[model samples]
Target chain A: MLKMTFARKVIAAAACAAALIAPAQAEEKTYRLKLAETWPTNFGTFSEPAREMAKLAEEMSNGRLQITIDTANKHKSPLGVFDMVRAGQYDLGHSASYYWKGKVPNTLYFTTMPFGMTAVEQYGWFYYGGGMELMQKVYEPLGLISVPGGNTGVQMGGWFRKEINSVEDLQGLKMRIPGFAGEVLAKLGASPTNIPPGELYTSLERGTIDALEWIGPAMDLRMGFHKIAPYYYTGWHEPATELQFLINKRTMDKLPEDLQKILLTAMKVSAYDMTINSHHVSAENWVTMTDEYPNIQVKSFPPEVMGAIKQANDELLEEAAAADPLAKEILTSQADYLKQIRVWTDIADRAYLNSMAE
Target chain B: MLKMTFARKVIAAAACAAALIAPAQAEEKTYRLKLAETWPTNFGTFSEPAREMAKLAEEMSNGRLQITIDTANKHKSPLGVFDMVRAGQYDLGHSASYYWKGKVPNTLYFTTMPFGMTAVEQYGWFYYGGGMELMQKVYEPLGLISVPGGNTGVQMGGWFRKEINSVEDLQGLKMRIPGFAGEVLAKLGASPTNIPPGELYTSLERGTIDALEWIGPAMDLRMGFHKIAPYYYTGWHEPATELQFLINKRTMDKLPEDLQKILLTAMKVSAYDMTINSHHVSAENWVTMTDEYPNIQVKSFPPEVMGAIKQANDELLEEAAAADPLAKEILTSQADYLKQIRVWTDIADRAYLNSMAE
Candidate 1:
């Protein structure tokens, strides 16, 4: 009986020791997160950032920070990513910040603006300039954290059935353009509408719309717009369309410091990777399109039409600024930054490219 | 004695259980790596990538990965990074790939060529257009792995004390240039020489050299060259000026797969970050320089001079290509990519910038 009592005491001591070590082991516990993306399954470049981010996060954390992503098909809510993430249904979301503009007006400014900075300039603005701080201010109030997801460098203006020679060309012109750009065009007496992606090609083919603006060659080739539209206009509205990664603030705060850093870095790197990937795919697709459709003509808007568009864009921006103090601050910051950076861009990249062409 | 035996058995069983779990704990083992950089400590933007990469790697790996860096000041070998990393004396290095041209002539093609692709185009080539495969072929043979470290955007041609109006002006013009670019200038009947960073100012001031090519406004503002040089020429040589990150093959192979991904992703993100940071700093510094030195003239070489330089560059490239099949392959690949992508660039970014300027 005494021996039995001793054995029980020894077992209790062992149990106490195990309990002491358990907490230390828990410190290395694996954290699993779920991410919902606005894109459907295998949505090409749009879907890349989330998958890459998750893989990197998991690998970097040595499998301790696993992030499983559900595409729109699974979630059955393409535009509901923000709501789901905010409600803690998903720990993170990948979508464009502008998509949430209806719910949060200030969120529109985070994505690319009409005639705004290029990819390089915008990235500079986000990282070194005050763009990131401004962006965080808009997102933090919504109980979320937003980072740049990726960039589509210099989106093509649109596929046009006919050339836009002057302001008259846009009069009552029915085109498919979305977001603030559409509003800008609407002010100029053009009817800008949004159509579901699946219906765009059919709509344009059946004369439901005169023209439509899609992504650049990287994504546009798959949509087969170049086959029907003879004139491809250069970009003006969405020069640098930066997608966004959103995370629930509470979800982020709960991770250990290292894992937090890991997740953030993963998102950042993957975002940049997507930018490069977009550029590559665009270059490749541009080649394919030109090779197959040699008759396709690339055009830029005439100066008169462009001038009118610019005027309308500026007026709309003025109205937005007047509507809110934060909008005014953000617009002023972007305009000032663009003015300063454009000078350097002209002397550096522009001059070199022109000289080389000569 | 019987009770004591039972207690000892219990203790032994507990110890065995702990031993069984120790290996799982060992999976979180910390890996420490040492990196050497080509730049001195606090060398402005050039030094940022290495430090940023190290910090991100550590944070992402949850303290399991630690990378420490030694700049040129500590290692006492600015140009020996390639040799040290190859020899496994340092696990990793941050330097420009072209710096190794003296030891490995083919290393010349990886950095930037005179009138080569811009940063965006170069990145496309690297990631999508078989540039990585070619680069790996060159470095793998050397028992090292080289990845792009960062970019300086478009480097300025140089600070010139005299205007270059024609090709005749380059005859016997003493200039401080380095690497393959110096070779190109030599073909144009110009006397090109290398001057250490510290000696460049005095050399140009005392007329030891008539002009000098350095980085752009981001790095050059502190050098105070704008105060003395009357003409700031646009870039032709080293258009993108991509720096390199080198790793010992053995060291990289020894790492766990997760840490490997972390290290690679960290390097890549930091590199892209530097590009944005360089643009930001340049924009800021350009403002500062112009504000202080209003007379600093930004010049592009006259077409005659630019044409002559291009002819010489082509001749040199031809000679290099003829010397090795691999060099020929790499050059052909880059030329083909540039040809295809430049068309898209011309229609897209170039047209937009020109249109906006008007």
Candidate 2:
């Protein structure tokens, strides 16, 4: 029995030795991905989390895969993130899918679809309810692999230069909005401009733009948006704004199976991190901004404006479904998911929120 | 005069040429850090973001700073995160600060204070209201530096084996809760056990633990906890649970000044990612668990239970503050910040939530 045990121990040591030495024989492939983002390095929204994902991927793969992300303008132009990734100039890109409405009409479904669903509902549809599969279908045609990167739970309407009294106030007003919302704003007789993060400060400061909307207070304060625009409007039109990571298909396909898995897993981690950080930073930013920038008047949108936005959202969603097959599928799926969720949400989630408020 | 003008042009050309050539000589020094985290690699909450930060740090620094994160149980136990980082066993540790209440009473402030602040309020106190300074003061003496890593915004009570009708029901109940709340539970006659994430499943499944309170629906659903308990409760006790990253001061000091800045920037991003992910995931998890787990029943605690929790929280805070001067300072600072925020939250946040609920 002692001799048998000694042989087993010897075999165990041999197995451990093989495990330790196996990795050295394997070839390490380092994939440096330039992720062009519309956020500064210090922006604690999705950009921060994207960075974290890259770090995790490298570690998890035992340094077999390396991804380096250019946070802002370090590589490609910030506003050009989508185009850059689509064209394979960048290995990865982080931005709102809605920002590229002209390129892919169905992209808006991944980011936001007017009053489509809440943050929770969106995640369900995307992950479990075939939302991710459809999203990949759309992105595959664009030469990219997309992942849900981050989300700002529910956003404020946006920062405004003046108080909006009615629907008429939105007419001809220059607003900084991206994605399908811009189309809706344009439909409402407003002019929309796609501005990158850094340029926002200069654009608002020089009166080049009348009104703008970023994530929310936490990020807005950092860029000193409140200093230039005293009237900050709530972002009711966008309750939950999602950010996405677009990886170059060619670059991603080159990675080994394990490395590819690491990147996907890392991206998932970043998605959650972005949400939590945005909430935390926004909360802190609101407090600090109020204390420091006392002149900044934060106000909710007037009932008329909110009513108009809601009405426009419904119309826009219907119009997109009617126009494109992919948009129709994604929107229909998202809507169906939302319909089911609303039943429970209305009864449980909403009820609880109401109960707690009192 | 013509010759002089030519000379000026030549000088300008030379200067422009110098500026163009400077890029070649601007190679940054790359510093690699090995970080240890208590979260599993599959746990997108911390591991994913931590990895992303490292990747972003390298990119933002143009390869000047690189970080590699070791996930939970990869190198050390999750419970050992604080001490491992403190003792310089690892460069950084990403986990909840509340896990180390026995060693540092004030560490809970970095995590969350029961009934004290929402996620936003906590961020406000930490970043702007000298809360970070206080944290540094508390951690520096222990050879560590801390930052807000992530937050679970207003969590669900937990999965209960049976409904909790009154305070009497909680007595002698074996519950799994972390941080100071666990201590409060102990004080209230319940048995509180600090179990790591990996072990939470079997303990709750085998009847070793009567209840377990994790972040919320998002995470709980993923862990499949609802399947066993079937009685989900709202976590009014932990409104906002904060996760923290503890960096070894020695390791941090070794980095170049710019690398240190990059590290801080990445941390802020990681925190944002974690918070947002929690919210988004929680939203979806709620829908899945309710739809799939038919036997699972989601309910809220009675007002009397909530009142008891609030009362217990107040007493715990008072006693803690009385015991530690630093804890008193942080609590006081948080109170001041919350007082200022309450005015707006009560009207804006609560009012909006109330109006939105059906």
Candidate 3:
């Protein structure tokens, strides 16, 4: 009986040892991921989403996968998020795809087309309508894997210093705008200048430019544009603008499979959170601007201006198709998809809106 | 062995019956839900969100939950969603809480407030900041249960006919607007008209309204507002407008747990999805508006017009607060929250936008 008891004890100890050894061998290797987003350290939507992504990653990884986020312009230039990730200078980046339109013209499909799909449709195109695949195609060329960072839903047209009466008014106006629309603005006789956020106020205030269009009231109001520009505009042009977080393909490929999944999941969560944050932030700013800073004026643009811009946009689109083959492909395919969805949304979406309007 | 097999067969048959019976029982309990909405059927965002809610309820319940969406005007009247829900005439409502400022003044905290929180922040407030609970408190008196149905993110101010050079331009202009901003417009000397989306085109065309403001390019394009109005303005005043789905408290309490969950989940999903869809739809429409519409004009409100509106908003806020205690509470709380988050978003959101502009 004594011998049996001793043997049992030894066997039990060995079993425990085996349990520990097995998990160690089978357990995925651990890693530390440091993400550097272009957002300023203080920007809530931009900074918080990255932080949320990191938090989710940590939770999903159970501390095995640790991701530290540098939200401010810490590691690289704010606009260099894509380039840094592409050049393998950073492990990840979160910024708008339209920002890198020069690098990947087709990428605008993933970010936004001038007045393209809403946030929902963009995600649909990305997830179901070959949008993600097409987006990958664009990102692959730049050695990056693009993930949806966040969506601003339907954006206002933008803020303006002066009222745009007609397309003729846009002509010769020094405006700060970007993306394909910026090019179109240029063609319409407006001098489109691409200025960074930090410079917008000073530039507008200093009279370096006559007009500037930024996100919507949420962002613009917080940035204190109301104090300088005095005119806040709509966001009809961009509509649903998507911000992207580009992860270096090689770096992402090297990550453990579970870690990769965590990265993607966390990003999506952050994206949703950021979008919600943006909505509230803009609202608060608008109220403050109007109520406290009555010196600022908030108003809309005229139909004549919209029409002229629309006409110029057609010329720009044709020119884009003519200039770039990828643009043509995206334009054609997107147009087809839009036509199909439009019919349904028009019937379903339009009818509902009309009912509510009454 | 024979006896065991027979018993097993009986058990299997019973299980199948139980499964079948469950659905049958659910099907027998029919529910007719009346939805009160702020918009008429013509607006996509307003109509689509509600349509989705109804569709989702029907599909999820396998057609047991029958929802009838009453256009804002049909059931009660415009700006009657909360009241109708409270009165038990409507089972559900889709509109902004801000529109019901007269009833539960704090209800505006749930919807988009000027310079308050973005859609994301509003979601956070509702979900995390006890905003939903607070919102429920405000609505409980009216017998309503409100959930976020949709958001337009940021919106355009309005379309203008002439150039606004200063605050003076706001005087004597008949503008179709909505929400609290309308009150501000009244103070600014502009005649504020709350024309639903369906009526905007006609009002502008007939000269009954000199200016009209509706969402951004996507919806505006579809309405052919560009044809009649000629000026497409930005959403400066109403940056991120949130839509709500108000369900009668009595009706909601009567729903089975499963059905209630489905109704809530579906509406939430639809809200996010609708926001995204609207953005995408707008983007596509913008392309058409600019390219196809020849006489259309896309312009911004002049500085002078903006200045006047901003001034009017300040006066309106003060008067509103003095006139109503609810407005004071809401405004104060919103201002506080805005101050807290602005510190972060200003850096992250603003810096990036400024960079993008460059």
Query: Considering only the true interface residues, what is the Cα RMSD of candidate 1 after superposition?
Result: 11.1
- Candidate 3 Cα outliers beyond 4 Å, as residue runs: A1-28, A343-358, B1-358
Q: Write the per-residue lDDT of candidate 2 for residues B244-298, one digit (tens) a residue.
A: 8788988888875445755776777567656656665665667787778777777
Evaluate model 1: give its TM-score: 0.93
Off by over 4 Å in 2: A1-113, A116-235, A240-312, A329-356, B1-32, B40-44, B55-77, B186-209, B217-224, B283-288, B342-357
The 10-residue segment with the lowest total lDDT in model 3 chain B = B19-28
Model 2 chain A TM-score equals: 0.82
- The DockQ for candidate 2, computed on C-alphas, is 0.04
Q: Over the stretch B70-97, how does candidate 1's per-residue lDDT look in tens digits?
A: 9999999999999999999999999999
TM-score of each: 0.93, 0.60, 0.53
Q: Rank the candidates by TM-score, best first.
A: 1, 2, 3
CA lDDT of each prediction against the hidden true structure = 0.88, 0.69, 0.65
C-alpha lDDT (0 to 100) for residue A131 of candidate 1? 95
> Tens digit of lDDT per residue, candidate 3, span B226-309?
666666555456555778888887888898654675577567767776666665666566667767766665445555565556
True contacts kept of each: 0.57, 0.01, 0.08
Q: What lDDT is obtained when candidate 1 is compared to the true structure? A: 0.88
Which lDDT tens digits does candidate 3 get at residues A1-358? 2343344334433433453334211222456766777787777556677777776555444344567766655664777777767777778877778777666667766777664665555675765466777777777867888878887755655556777777778778888887678877887888988897878889988889988777766666667777766665554467568788778888888875435655765676578667666666655556666777777654445656665666777677777788988778777767677655544343333322222222
Candidate 3 versus the native: TM-score? 0.53
